[model samples]
Target: MKVPETALPDERPNTGARPVDYDAELRLHNRAFRHACAILARERVLDIGCGAGQTTRDAARAASAGSAMGIDTSSSMIARARELAAAEDVRNVRFELGDAQTHSFPPQGFDVAISRFGTMFFADPIAAFRNIRGALADDGRLIMMVWQALEANEWSLAIQGDRPQSSAAFSLADPSLAKKILDAAGFADATFQDVHEPVYYGDSVEAALAWIGQFQATREALRSLDAAAVERERTRLREAVAQHHRDDGVWFDSRAWIISARCR
Candidate 1:
């Protein structure tokens, strides 16, 4: 769930994958949120990089008595999120478009902060986390999921194909470095757990290609090549997906870090 080095709106291709790939996203990221929500009786929650507000809406349901706010840098995403919430008649949720890195979130405004496939793109992660930390109450909880190394994640490796790795997406892939960044950002009690999940690329090979081909990085990589070369690479991608195809869909082996920390 990483994006090319671009604005937040263009961060992801609107392949309608988020809703369809619920299993992948949940196994890799939301499992922690669900587990935490089950044990803790929370009142307020904040969801960052809350792509379509699904996670935000879920958290709002958990904090039914309180409220949940979803923030992202993409206005269109926020709009669609708002529409979804409205359609569901969910009143406890709200979505805003703003960069978490510099956004002045209300201080001590939330008891829990969550990010799924977000936070990796922050230009200055320490500053971003510090800002997020400030938005939490004392002893507040921070929960998020980050991708693992390139070698561990076959999904990205398949897409790479001699392409340069995305710096922003993989910036926090290393647990040690992620811990150091959190520590510097005034978060404590860092715990990183290994999570292996199946990421659904598409229902079929053609579907997968259509969705994956829209990735900004993919287009960038292919932009330099001629049609024949692009087709060759596309064929390679199709072949790679074939090996991982399943009865349900095209699933890629994925590895992520489920991180939990308390604001210091």
Candidate 2:
């Protein structure tokens, strides 16, 4: 199951270089994996949107006799995943770059499917889950994490302000809606468990401001406002970060749903 080396750009999507948000978000996702690993059957596992393959490698280790496959749309992520797997000498894991919505996964090949805050961005969630169902063995488990409502997640609220509609992270925020979509996608017993955690943004206000400013959309949204208004917004954000500052770093509350279902 050893995979070959792949080249990546200077930065990857799920890496710390991309955004500090990803760092905290990744913690949430990986934390969910610890709970989801209970379903591993040591047959075969597939990690959808497996950014850097840490969870994929973990699954591979859990399924020592089997194999793990990590697939993501970003080639950089896939490449970095391969590098991590190689650096760890992980032979039972592989990474591929492909879109989960239409990727040609093997028929009934996986015993369990896992994702970490990765399945929410699909243009057609039902179609994507249906395709994922096709990749699983009969009655295989689908364990993944999606965000709760925008208002529930403090970090999202702080950064998003009045513009929470831009990101697809909250698409599955509603439990009933998520269950309905999964049911339509040929999955059964969709469940959402509330997971409250704190997301680390930065060690200082300057650091947090720098990281938060990386969000170009926020800048774009504020472009129409006069300089004073923009400064006021910036000051608002800085004060918000300062309120959450701690000895270790800046942390904010976040809420997520640990969704689990079975392929029907």
Candidate 3:
């Protein structure tokens, strides 16, 4: 299925024709986040922590008369994002490697800023957002998707069974705290919409296993186990993932928030 440039929250799944190598889990959230963005022509966009430029490219496509720039801390991810943009001939987008919290973005340069599960890792969210706010035009919008909480996401639980859930990914789980942070950072009217969707792992059990194994939590857990214990753990993980398998793919329920706010 060719993913639409924009979609409503209630739209049907559009991943049936996605490339096999695409990030399946992210594809689920992509639809909702892109829909919320609603990029417009001639509007400059900035994408924070844009992993591999998926969101940035989407924004660029929609903002055909404008331009989009993506920033991330990972050099490799930035490089890959550039490569993909070039390969796809998306000329209106660019990627940079930098930390959002301190990066000196052009003042009031962007009409919109966006993220996809990417705003949860700031060492200091208030400062980060303040900087972002400075980069936005007056009344500019911020649209982002963030995981609700570890307990609310089945994919994390299934993959890292029983492990103490501690990650930057869930930093913005509390709606009240998120609102407070945004308000303090010069944003107004922070609102959140609940998003419940099943994250796709892969088309088969083995494929899903390979993808899950690449997670830092899973790899760390396996490294701490002895060879025999590791094998047992792998077996356990396989069984857990298999439980969610369907004729089309492996999936797990997840909950997230699509938070939208405006620059004060």
| TM-score top scorer | 3
Per residue, candidate 3 scores C-alpha lDDT tens digits across 1-264 of 433322211223334433233345778778888999999989999999988899999999999999999999989899999999999999999999999999999999999999998899999999999999999999799999999989999888887777677667888989999999999999989899899988887787765766666666776776687878877777788799789989988889999999999988
TM-score of 3: 0.90
TM-score of 1: 0.88
Candidate 2's TM-score reads 0.84
Model 2 Cα lDDT, one tens digit per residue, 52-85: 8877888888888889999999898889899989
Question: What stretches of model 2 exceed 4 Å from their correct place?
Answer: 1-25, 39-41, 216-230
Candidate 1 ranges beyond 4 A from true positions: 1-29, 37-42
Q: What is the C-alpha lDDT of each candidate?
A: 0.78, 0.78, 0.85
Off by over 4 Å in 3: 1-22
Which ten contiguous residues of candidate 3 have the minimum total lDDT?
A: 3-12
Superior by lDDT: candidate 2 or candidate 3: 3
lDDT string for model 1 (1-264, tens) is 544343122224335433333434355456655664442435788889988888888888878788899999888888989999999999988998999999989999998898888889998899999999999999788988778887888888888867778767778888789899999988999888777876777766655665566567887877777878877877787788778778877788888887899888
Return the TM-score for each candidate structure: 0.88, 0.84, 0.90
The candidate that achieves the highest lDDT relative to the unseen native structure: 3
